[model samples]
Target: MKTDTLFKRAFNDALLLTSRLRDGDPIPSETTLAAELGVSRTTVRKILQTLTEQGVVAGAGRSRFARASAGEVQPFPEAETVPTSVQVEKQFMEWMLRGDAKAGALINELDLARQFKVATTVIREFLNSFQRFGLIERRPSGGWVLQGFTHSFALELFEIREMFELRSAREFSSLPGTSPLWHELRRLRQEHIELLSEIETRFQDFSDLDSRFHRLVNTAVPNRFIDGFFDIITLIFHYHYQWNKKDERERNEVAIREHLAYIDALLSRSRSAVATACRRHLASARQTLIRSTSDTGSVA
Candidate 1:
């Protein structure tokens, strides 16, 4: 499992377990909690630290942990921990979605690191991930600039995206109903409906949701190359296109409905139906990317 997810699971489990205890009740040892949760002792330690910070538990150097006094027992802590790589990506995407930077704008590693609370190397590595797509450029002197996609750039990438997704949809159609992917897809479908219901007030949130929905759809495929292309594809089609606010609400509403159709088709387990839905959504995405790049003032 992803470290962040494991950490969260352990955190929640810790909270639930501790809620059952009272003042002066000794909490389980790190090793015991680790074994019970099937996570590392280090993960348990992190959870304990959070609990300590929230006044859920109390201990020090050589002291064993015990539930804090009734008045001292604070509410459960918020889920905000250190930012994971996935979170960094979403923050970066949201930054774009909010028009924080424009196309062709220069980006400094230090500034991005500060903005995202990540290291300069982390920012550099993230930019490197998209280096193959040519939307980011490094200067000989210093720094990077956000680059715009040419028509040729979008068309070329779309061809590869179409191949990858179609193949994924074909394979996903045959997956057993018990597959975890189905559970995730169903969750995504519900999210689409929820977002669509609130589209007018929360239209800007669609870009992140759209990125998540497509990423979940492609999870059945196991090709590293396809995965690499997905980063670029999502950055452009999912986040960048929304830089244009023209009929944004209408476009997002339609896309959410299309996503519901796509989800239903996949759950039907018919290869032909899945293919049709995949093509329809991808074609819409392709058109959006083409239009976004062509519109002079849309980039941000």
Candidate 2:
């Protein structure tokens, strides 16, 4: 199933690329296409073969050429190309962030399956994953129940978050000057500047930026556990940002500035500075989460 999704996504991308070429234009080489699509050469070959079978391309191997115009072929629907788990997770998060699910609310697998356009089993699996974090609990009869975001849970979660982020920040500070992370960091810094300039209207956009920035920091030294924990953090923070609307703009503006300082510290390559900046930003985040939880009384 996963492979099929990957192939469909790659095929759609290839189709888009082919559409941009004039009729009879030479198809890119397999190696070139693989690099462009960020897929294995074998996948690229499969995509070319599929394209040939669909009458979208003519000839074979290096002699292949575009045989159809953009209007002749249709790309796969955007949703069909994404894995069901990913789609379900995204829908679940959006549902929670939209305030559709309250603390201690029962999770209706059938309803969620219908809402997300997925199967009941998919919703069950997603809820099961959340069970480990105590964010959801399986009911005796069936289905699951959403848990509140308790103050104690917030403290414990942020404690681990700080540890992981601080370690990642320290590793980032030690990264070689030639590392690509430096380029990404610079680009993110520019994005932060742009967002800050228009913060009043764009403050709501900070949730995604916050997630991206932290994810990049974690890239300095990848750990599967850290990556998984970050998923929870992203969802919780996203929920908090949405649920806590009072002073939302001010809160996000402060966070953006803090991120800039954190970025500067990492760029400086100073261990002490990185540690200080990481802790400071994390402390602020901890406080914000605490405040939100207190205000909502949503978390037990």
**Model 1: colliding residue pairs:** none
Off by over 4 Å in 1: 1-21, 32-56, 59-65, 68-80, 84-123, 130-133, 138-145, 149-156, 174-221, 235-249, 263-273, 289-300
Report every candidate's CA lDDT.
0.75, 0.84
lDDT of 1 by residue, 1-300 (tens): 223766775677777788778778878878888998888989888888888877778886446566646354433344443345666777776665455666678887889899998787888888777567776688788778766455666788889889998998888888877889999888888888888888879987888888887777778867788888888787676556545677888888888888889899999988888889989988997887776653121342
Highest TM-score against the true fold, candidate: 2
Q: Give the per-residue lDDT digits (tens) of candidate 2, residues 1-300.
A: 223788889999998898888889999899999999989999999898888888888898669898865346767888779977777866776675455677778888899999987777778888888676656778898778776566666898999999999999988989999999999999999999999999979989999999999999999999999999998898788767766788899989999999999999999988998899889999998998887663133431
> What overall lDDT, based on C-alpha atoms, would model 1 receive against the true structure?
0.75
**Poorest lDDT segment (10 consecutive residues) of candidate 2:** 291-300
Our model 2 lands, by Cα RMSD against the true structure, at: 4.7
TM-score of 2: 0.70
TM-score, cand. 1:
0.60
Overall local distance difference test of candidate 2: 0.84
